[model samples]
Target: MNKKKTSLLPKNFLFRLTFINIFIVSIFIALSSWAVYNTACFLVDSMGTMTGTNQTKFNKTLYYYLWIFSLIAMITGSIAHFYLTKRLIHPLKRLIESTKSMKKGNYPEPIEVTSSDEIGQLTSNFNGLAHQLKKNHEQRQKLVMDLSHEVRTPLANLNGYLYALKNGVIEGDPALYESLYQESERLTKMITQLETLKEWDYISEQSFFEKEMAPIGKLLHETVKMFEWQLKEKQIAVEIDAEDADLLVDKEGVLQAISNLTENAIRFYSGEGIISIKGERLANEYYIAITGPSYPITEKEGEKLFERFYRVDPSRSRDTGGSGLGLSITKEIIEQHKGDIGWKTDEAKNTFWFTLPLETACTSR
Candidate 1:
């Protein structure tokens, strides 16, 4: 059972506002009438009682006109006050309704901004917030669907293996167990990477990092060292041609970004090849590029290289032990450090590059 929540404000809030404004106007009018009356009486008394009858007639006429003017002002002023109050309160009412819609998980249409006042600004800000929330909601839905798609195959594989073992349709062998374990491990790794991508996506907004001034060249060297065994196994030679420029960045994040790029290079290298890693300072930015052998990718494919779960060759990536989120995580880390990441193809070689601002406060492109 659910109960509807009650609002704190009264239903006749606009009426109350109108009444309060009219009450204030009436107070001012009454004070003015009292002052005028006192002044008229003083003037009449100052006439030294010479024209007593005339003064009496003048006092009556003055009082009568004063009462009539006050009556007229009160009526007209109340009507105008009510109209203006209604105009101001109408937008607030619309905002409240829009808020309720959002609370019910339905995004509302943009509220019209009809003024250059604070209320108009508030409405504009609310529209921007609604747009962002709607975008996030859509992305979340897509993520759930993509996650289910990625999980289903591995789960099916594991279920088939378990069913066969339980039904005694096939004897359990070491190879069978290894295959099942591999499927389970792939599922675990995909989920872990998805969680990592989610965490970094959130952390990017907060700018959370342990930033330090580190040499770009040294970071590249360290990243290459981390993958020495894999590079040697693949017979891939990594050559670093980097400038020893200092960058203000999070060392752990930068290292992770570089490591992802390096691992990607090793994974996609066509046969035994040389992977060139270059870092240079261009203007106020430190640029890093990793060039290695890869299959031809179109401009459209290149554009989506950093999107989560995106793969140019999904089977090839899976066989190479990729979760299809390495580049996405790298992009997140680079952007969080106020940088840009992209890729380009030249002949048979593909180059993945990124740029970091020399100053940590610079905006990302």
Candidate 2:
């Protein structure tokens, strides 16, 4: 025989609680009735005029009435208990079904909030989690598709060039070889960036980062100096206004983030334009901003600017030899430090800014 799984008691939380409360109440009533009957018997025994028959009759009448009253109370309590349990368990059951749907990759209708209680709060949290999971899953799908498209172009070009050379359709001229080498180099760079992004994703997901109190101003200055050659090549003037501020962060990660921002500024700034770097303390955080002259970007484009392989201008990204992962990596680094990074633009300038929490106790490295 196929036996269905069964629970000895109600599995719903409210039902179980009600059952326990009723059981305790019943025990109290029974004890009280016993005490009342014993007191009645003692009083009757003290009266000499009362006979055995009278005593027996009195006891029977008292016990019968007590049983009837207890039965009435139990029935009333059970009716009230059932009503209360229904109100509370209905929402919980809906929530359980929603979760099961989510497990099957189906996002069903949201649970309705019927009350302001712990259960209601739990429902709200569950809704938020479901929304987040759906968003992340969509983003993951888009990332995979984008990555595939990005890799295919370079790969196709490399394959075509190599095939042409193999068939003797193209001579072993130095220029032809150089072109082939550049295509291969582009692929290598893309692969390297992909690997770096993967590592960064792992680190961010694991909340893993080395923390040390490091000077923010010095880091910004050093990062700017590292790009001096590019700044000069682009004929871009540099301005720096940094204050002494220390932050607890992964030093290498911070350095890399600053370097990436500076490199981005150098790449996009108009020739002979100025790039400004600023670092200062803002309340409890050290803020760093990099501003450069560039074309304006729409709000929609700016929203996905930090997404891997996303580019404000695809042609500009190619011309500048960008892999389109720098900002994404920098965003992760800043977020790992429990901070924020974003971009803002005006008619004359484009600014990328980030912040890190300031370390109160400064320590020398």
Candidate 3:
């Protein structure tokens, strides 16, 4: 069977709108001409002395005038309809062309919003979406470049050390071996964090939380316990103040988030400083905060603290500052639990806090 060929012109919105408008105009012209013709006939018939020949002539003249009027009306209506349709469909055409350009990875200028109609709203939304996509593209490119630079530095160091030792350019001293090992360790840590971040990115928010509800106080205690050795090494005093609150969360995910925050606090705290963990129930949510003494961070830096690969102290070595993905992972975990995480800094302290919804708090009561 042969498929029917479709006319591209008729498929256009302008063509369809103009055709419908012209059809309506034709109907109105026909009805108007009929009414006028009928009125003329009625007036002629009412003239009692009118002869058949005169009547026929008058009727023919009336029909001729009606035909002329109809033709004029049709021509004028068609021209007006075409102009109106073109105005209405011009924006749509621009949108289609812009989308095609975007498909080719070229974002042209924003679609001009000419009206407050649905099409105008759509144009505005498209502009916003294009801007966001361009921003994300730039960020992704930067991330790739940064990742390469980070990995290359450690790898190059390791390679240089190994090559020097193999060629007898440098003795295989214990310090040299330790340095090489540390470089290898840094590379492994960064790679592992990257993989973990990728997996976390793929996880959906709905499935992030497990069905079990864990006590906030207990989780905080356990998380602090895990960092006992680090706390001791740093001589950081610990304090915990928590309310008895249960949160609907993924047990392991929440644990890891708290652990990361604690570890962050431990790493950045001043020598022999105090680390405080606080938890409290606020309405339908439970809030957890970990604070430590440190130099104040600007509000701007705090805003980006949870972003992947963001470092507070840019000069600090990765070995001391970590892969910079720990806080990012923690942010993701808290967000997946329908929570918010942020940091605040004062004159002599920095605090990281997060809130998780108490899903059954009211029901249990």
Report the alpha-carbon TM-score of model 1 versus the true structure.
Answer: 0.88
Q: Order of candidates by TM-score, top first?
A: 1, 2, 3
1-365 per-residue lDDT for model 2 (tens digits): 21122221225566678888899988988888889988987888788667899888988998899889988888898789878787767777678668768878988766777667999899988888888788778868987897787888778887898898899897788887887787788778878877777777778767355677778888888887888787677677889998886667788989999988888887777634678899877767778899988877779889889988777664644546477888988998888888899999988688999988765535334
Per-model RMSD to reference:
3.8, 4.5, 5.9
Q: How well is each residue in 272-361 modelled by candidate 3, as lDDT tens digits?
A: 468889998888788899999977888777777887878776465776777788898888777877789998886789899999887665
Tell me the spans in candidate 2 whose CA falls farther than 4 Å from its real position: 1-35, 47-49, 109-125, 172-174, 191-210, 228-239, 281-285, 292-304, 314-321, 335-349, 357-365
Residue 207 lDDT (model 3): 45
Candidate closer to the true structure by lDDT (higher is better), 1 or 2: 1
TM-scores of all candidate predictions against the true structure = 0.88, 0.76, 0.72
Q: What's model 3's lDDT at 285?
A: 87
Compare candidates 2 and 3 on TM-score and give the better one.
Answer: 2
Ranking by lDDT: 1, 3, 2
Candidate 2: worst-modelled 10 consecutive residues by lDDT: 1-10
Once model 3 is optimally superposed onto the true structure by TM-score, how far is the C-alpha of residue 357 displaced, in angstroms? 5.5
> Number of the top candidate by TM-score?
1
For model 1, the run of ten residues with the poorest summed lDDT: 1-10
Query: Which pairs clash inside model 1?
Result: none
Count of clashes, each model: 0, 0, 0
